[model samples]
Target: MNILMMTNTYLPFVGGVERSVQIFTGEYRRLGHQVLIVAPSSSQQIPSDETGVLRVPAIQHFNGTDFSVPLPIPGILNAALKQFKPDIVHSHHPFIIGDSALRISAQLKIPIVFTFHTFYERYTHYVPGDSKALKKFVIALATGYANLCDFVFAPSLSVAVELRRRGVLSHMEIIPTGIETELFLNGDRRVARKWLGINEDVFVIGCVSRLAPEKNIDFLVLSVKKFLEKRRKVCFLLIGSGPCEDKIKANLKNEIIEGKVIMPGTVTSQPLIDCYHAMDLFVFASKTETQGLVITEAMASGVPVVALRASGVAEVIDDKKNGCIVENESCEDFVSAMNWVQGWGRKNNLKRNAINTASKYTKEICAQKALTVYEGLRRKNHILRNHSESTWETAKRLIKAEMDIIKNMTRATGMAITNK
Candidate 1:
């Protein structure tokens, strides 16, 4: 089957959504299916021999401390859709590129599917107060498009619930963002620690995400500070870069925890897995995530996660089992959870459980489930359209037969009256 994946950003523009699309599309291709990706063009575009990538021209804008938006390339996208002629159009974001895909899907009468990756309502604070109204409006627009789709895929149950709350009672499927299991298994903790110059005795608490306001990096910083107040031998490793890198640095400076904090900006998959391997614990305080792919990545690397009970994160993390979940957004709770993980002293058990949990969310498994949903949607659409067409044909035949009988009756009646 030919599948077209439309996303706002693609390779080289790193994020959870991009990673999810990459993994899913890769798996789709591995299954001997043709896959095409449509995304905003970057400076460096990777070539795909089997899978194709069509980059559309777009304008980029930075919103808050670390968030950016890519406006849609309308004309280029329309032309690409005409040439690609995909069997299915799967969209990641429900705006901009997602909208373009929806429109093209309609024009071509192709089945469209959407994966609700981000909750725009949660990030409304990024926009100005007066513009806040646009948040609900944007959600409404997304819902409109979602209703038109063959199926709407949510990375977590929480996302699916939110879509329902927003009146998107249409077809919704819950699938978690998956991770590459073998990559984490290949990581070497000793080598990773030596590369980062992290001491052997210090307990490493790490966060892998874009350093941005919506991520609540401040909470992680404050919680680490609180943890250091008692445990001075702990190190905090923050991976990934964003607009808030300097601000986070300044904040760490203000707290005078520079020595304890390590910011290695944006490493790729292997190094990131190694960083996770080197860490004793993974601390993620971001409340805005739909699925928190990094949490699963850390878990796959055998690092226990200390995260808030927010959004779809709960679906991946079983509190006190694989990882500890802080019920509230309080820094004190985060610090307490960190201390709990430290005192648990069952590092091996926690790590084992985490690996087991993450194993369940492998890319191949997720892709299979997603493909099942896509196949079901295709079948359903075919059945529905066929039934509608059959009904229309039956109605037309009935009308034509009735008209013929009426004309014969009128002719007979006219002849009888003329003979009389």
Candidate 2:
């Protein structure tokens, strides 16, 4: 299959959606499919190692923003689409490149899919309007864009419900992005702790996410402050950099100075895996994730989670099983949950369960599941292509398509068994 992915961000951006798209592209290629990515030009030059990536002209760079608006050069994009003749187009966002994807899909009579990656309601501060009004507008925008797509991919059931509630009547699939489980699983904790200059006796609580107001980092700081009062041997490691860095640092000035909190800016690849290894527990305060990919990464590293109960975090964690879940957003509740879980009696069992939960969401499995959805959509489109046909003929074609799908699935399963 030939696949075209359009996104405002890719690769070097170092976010969940970017990483998810990269994983999908590579996995599709490994399965003998052709993949091409169209993304906005970054201020930084595209790395030589990146292949099959085409850049659009970027017009402005907002200092604190995760994206740049690429001038929609229709002629250039049209030429590329014409030459590729992709079987499907998968867009990562609702606006920006997604609008371009919609245009090209209409022109070429191709089916397009969009993934609902963010809970835009939580990001109202970025726009110039009342928070309530901005949130309503964001929901409307998401609903309108979802209605235009041939299919919508929701990373979690909660997101799917939200899209439906906002009037997304289009076909939707609930799919989670996969993690590179082995990368985290194989990291050497001793070496990682040594590299981070962490002492063996000190218990580390870590959080890896973009520093942003929407993430509720200030609230998390408050929770950490309360938790640290009793457990003086514990420290917090805050990873990743974002627009809220300076704000968060100022908010936690005393904690930073006292060595109770460490901000490592940003780290990637093995270094990122190493950070996960050095932590005894992972903490997440964000309620905006469509799917908490970082939570899974931490679990795959055999580190249990202690997170506020919200959004996809609830989907990935079972309270007292894989990890501890704070019952409310209150600082006192969060701190209390942390203290309760720090007892160390159930720590080993929780770690084992966390690893088991993460094993179910590997990159390979996610790719296979996504491909199945794509194939099903393509088959449906193929069966419905002859609009001039009679209703009886269409019915016959639908039955034939279903039979083909079943046969293909059975044969594939047999092949896997034989190989095993």
Q: Which candidate ranks first by lDDT, i.e. highest?
A: 2
Candidate 1 ranges with C-alpha deviation above 4 Å: 43-51, 62-83, 125-130, 254-256, 382-420
Candidate 1, run of 10 with poorest lDDT: 411-420
Report the lDDT tens digits of candidate 1 across residue range 169-230: 67888887777898887798888899999988889888898877789888887878778666
| 286-317: candidate 2 lDDT, tens digit per residue | 88888989999999999888888787888899
Candidate 1 lands at a TM-score of 0.86
lDDT of each: 0.77, 0.80
Instruction: Give each model a TM-score.
Output: 0.86, 0.88
Candidate 1: residue 401 lDDT (0-100): 38
- CA shift at 70, candidate 2, in angstroms? 2.1
Error of 1 at 364 (Å): 1.0
Residue 170 CA displacement from its true place in model 2, Å: 1.3
- Which portions of model 2 show Cα errors greater than 4 Å? 63-66, 255-257, 386-420
Model 2 scores worst on lDDT over the 10 consecutive residues at 411-420
**Could you tell me which residue pairs clash in candidate 2?**
none
lDDT of 1: 0.77
